[model samples]
Target chain A: MRVSLFALILVSGITFTTAQEKDELPALDNPHNYIKLLAQDAALPALQGEEKFILRESWWSGRMEPGKAKLIQVQLFRRNAYQFWLAVPNRNGEPIINVYDSEGNLIPSESLNFEGTNIVSTMIQPEITGVYYIRVSLKTTIESPQDWAVIYAYR
Target chain B: MTRFFLFLAVSVLSSQWGLAQEAPVKIDLEDPNLVFVSDSVIPIPLEIFASLDKMGAQDWGRQIESRDIRLDANRSRTAMLFGLVVSEGFIGVQAQDKESVRRLGRDVLALARSLGVSAEVEEHANAIVNGAGRGEWEMVRQELDKTRQTVINKMKELRDDELVALVSLGGWLGGTEALASVLRDNYSAEGSDLLNQPELIKQLKLDFNGLPKRARRGDLFTQVSQTLEHLESLMRSDDTGAISEGKVIEISLATRNLVEAIYES
Candidate 1:
């Protein structure tokens, strides 16, 4: 599953490692080929040690009215150059991703827009080294009396 | 004995609502359980508040307000403040811990007046910046209510984002009664009449089109969404036929995700 595009280039020094297991995998042009999140799993194997959170996956909900705005909280741990992807299965075709500096300011709001899915992804840099939050809720004007959002994050 | 039982019942219901808020460190002014936690903010530079005031754009060298300079330099420990700012704009706030995040949220709420959407926002800004005391919570609630009323009142001031309410209500069935009540009270009959008239729904479609092309997409369930919302609102109008709290909870969950994602966020 660790078929890193960059790693393949860096390890080019080795003459033949037999193309690695990921060779059997197609290039990630399709959502079907992309890695699927099946559980509340650790991101990147905890290289910086254990970081804790309350609700990390699609595990939370908020009460909002058609006229009131609500913010959903997803907390991230540690500050590093890491990517954050957001998806709403019921929303627009692509995910809107925003990259931020360590200070939580936007670097850019990017989109991965994986086909067949409505997910947004971005790279984030935390201003500090603790839990960072992402708001996954509705704007008052866009709010349906029945509308809310679902979000999950990986470090 | 009945009084004792009633007391226990009230306490139990309130406690459960606290559990439902889902925040690891939620401080609800409305919740009785939260009274145990002290309401104090970790003070920072008044310059921080000043900087936020000037944040309309990403100007590299925008001048700061002179009042902020005096407040920043005042450094009076005798005066403490209730915070009314949301933690979003502050640098690195998105990265803070739960306690820290809640503190920022609480402070922001306390400083709500300082958030100054108007020139009068400047007058109360320092009072809010200094923080709201127990005497101020009622005013805060009142202020929030007035803001809600003002928005509903100025429906012609409605923009594309304002369309959120129309769609969420889903053809006036979900909570049209509740919305109607709000609208009639805030907006004139001339203004609010369209809220119920089918012609307004048609006008809404036209208005929605005038928005930015890529601003947002109609929901996946857009096909039957309007019908469903109208049905829900109609059902809601009659309190007797309403669904149980559990199913209503499920619908509430769906609405929050959809409405927030499609319109709000």
Candidate 2:
């Protein structure tokens, strides 16, 4: 049997299938089965199941010394898919955190507030199975003024 | 063993892919009068001084023409304190060297003029510093008594009793020097006369005219301006505090001292 999976937008503003829908869908009924299909939407490479494997960490003790950025990278993948997310915590004042992608591409960084700290999390949705990488650094301010965030990801 | 490697490979591959990876999302966080929205989804208090006003709609028409040069009271206070410290700490002359003392005296006069202190004190302070550096000790000693009374009169408009105590202590601490080397160059007669004179403590009470501390907190543009204007004329003060600077340092000093002493003791 074939059924059309309509996009019933969730109220949480995140446009991905929730747990309930994932359970009911026969396409994913077998946990042992992996998906291989045509390009449903080529532009939508993110197939709407990320943030699940996001690493979880409890503490960032703020031992960040001068001239440093707390770098964080979260990578997710399946057999034929690769996904990546990278972000640096905003440390306000004169310093800031810089973010870089797997290909060593530079992205803009941000500043933290007066308390002089910030945290960011990465959630990547995989479309094709491939390996991914992330690089993070400080774009502005003194170096190493922050501590590394606890990496929280699903085992 | 193959299956275990497969499982490990799959798990490693999964970890590397970030399976749930999605494009970054950002909410249009609007702050009407936000000061430093430096972090988080949380809202912080507004610094409400510049182009942003909480009450009115953001007039984009005027915004293009407008500048954020509304001179935040915070910036003014910070800048003023910096200026005050520079003036007091770095600009004054000691009896270290003849040429150096003359240079410092010149610099102090320039700073006083630029900072807009009254001309009388400026000139008197200049003459004394210069004369003492020149070994014209009598002229230096006379100006000391004059500056003492001048600064004392300047403090009278203060409503802050605590601040008055601070200024009093500062005056007394500054007193020993003012009579010795400082006054010796300006006023030798009153130099020894008021060295540790208990009567000189009366200058602490000179600050009775400024409004109560609480009244000084709000819309200083309205309150501080009007009150300072009235008090300036009453005290015969210069137009230094005429601008609605929320921080009147001289006024704050009297209150700051007493509060510090209280807190410390």
Candidate 3:
């Protein structure tokens, strides 16, 4: 009986450690995944028939509090049509995305509103190559942090 | 066999228990964004090359004198050379130069061996050479991208952050040199826009400052910083990040001179 108990304890310890390691992995089902989905959705209706060269890295995600602004700086290349997607699962937090050039002047861009959807996307064609800062903000007054993600692809 | 069965059972039960504990985290089932998809962000070198390629830049490999870059004991210099070689691989694909691609592949392997990362790089370089032989441009590009990422990830794994920064700086310079060379010969409005990268300059400034004092004091780093400052002024000249043709020439010359300096020193 003692030998059996010892085996059981060892098995449990090993299994627990294995499970703990899996749980400690970077959260896969977060806002970043959502941004990727939105990017796929944008590919269909928006970039239809265009050969899409999807950039599958550099997706940035963070928690944004209501009534606060978060600025993410990204370098964009010239002469490529880039589509940027911003989305969150929460409906109470209305998120707006905008792009600005290096001098902080707003660049003209077309944005798709999320009236009944959980995703917002924008497409910009920078005539010149340079760094552009994207400002994402929540318009609501919720105290809880809303997880958000921004992703872009150029073709 | 009995012990194996018991272990499997325990693992399965433990996983189920973990799911049970994680179930109460309140994930919204109705959210359409919950549908998972596979994609990743674009790296800066790839972005720059894509833009340059779109603007009808051709035979960029002729502009890259990667042969001049030498291997060194300093991991930082080695890392930088690796970046230039990978960028050269991209131009080889653009130029469809099989011999150059194969040579750069072997060179990348040599550099990786010096940095203690030959294991991860050997396969990618082999695939790159093999792909180039078949004129599989897309496959070669993918392998090159993987090679760059693998090297950077290995550097990070070894806790060599300084090398990581230097590798990127090297790749950036290589890409810039290629682009600037094309622009120098064929000055188009669209081609000039690709150099409007003030944000990258700012980030590089921060990266340069973050380097260890030993690396920061290095002559290469100091000279690169001076060039970055010059590029920054050019990028910020207009709100739209546009630069004059003359400014483009200046940057192109500065970048080419810097690349030469890298090879000489």
Q: Give the candidate number with the greatest DockQ.
A: 3
TM-score of each: 0.23, 0.21, 0.70
Q: Identify the leading candidate in terms of TM-score.
A: 3
Under CAPRI classification, how is model 1 graded?
Answer: incorrect
Query: Candidate 1 lDDT, tens digit per residue, B33-67?
Result: 22111111111111122222222222211211111
Model 3 chain A: which ten-residue window has the lowest total lDDT? A11-20
TM-score of 3: 0.70
lDDT of 1 by residue, A1-155 (tens): 23452343233221233334754533333222122221112222322355421222122232334333233222222222334444433343222223322233443332333333334344444332222333332223333333223323333
Clashes of each: 50, 56, 9
Please give the distance, in angstroms, between residue A107's alpha carbon in candidate 1 and its true position after superposition: 58
- All models: lDDT? 0.29, 0.29, 0.68
Q: Supply candidate 3's per-residue lDDT for A84.
A: 73
Model 1 residue B178 CA deviation (Å) reads: 15
lDDT of each residue in B31-87, candidate 2, tens digit only:
242121111110000101011221232222211111011223332222222222222
Task: Indicate whether candidate 1 or candidate 3 has the larger DockQ.
Answer: 3
Which runs of model 2 end up more than 4 angstroms from their true locations?
A1-155, B1-104, B107-111, B151-169, B176-211, B214-265
Off by over 4 Å in 3: A1-50, A87-96, A103-106, A112-119, A138-143, A146-148, B1-46, B49-57, B66-69, B234-246
Candidate 3 per-residue lDDT over residues A5-120, each given as its tens digit: 33433532212223346434222333355444543444444544567655433466777777666666677876677777777657666667767666666667767654434456
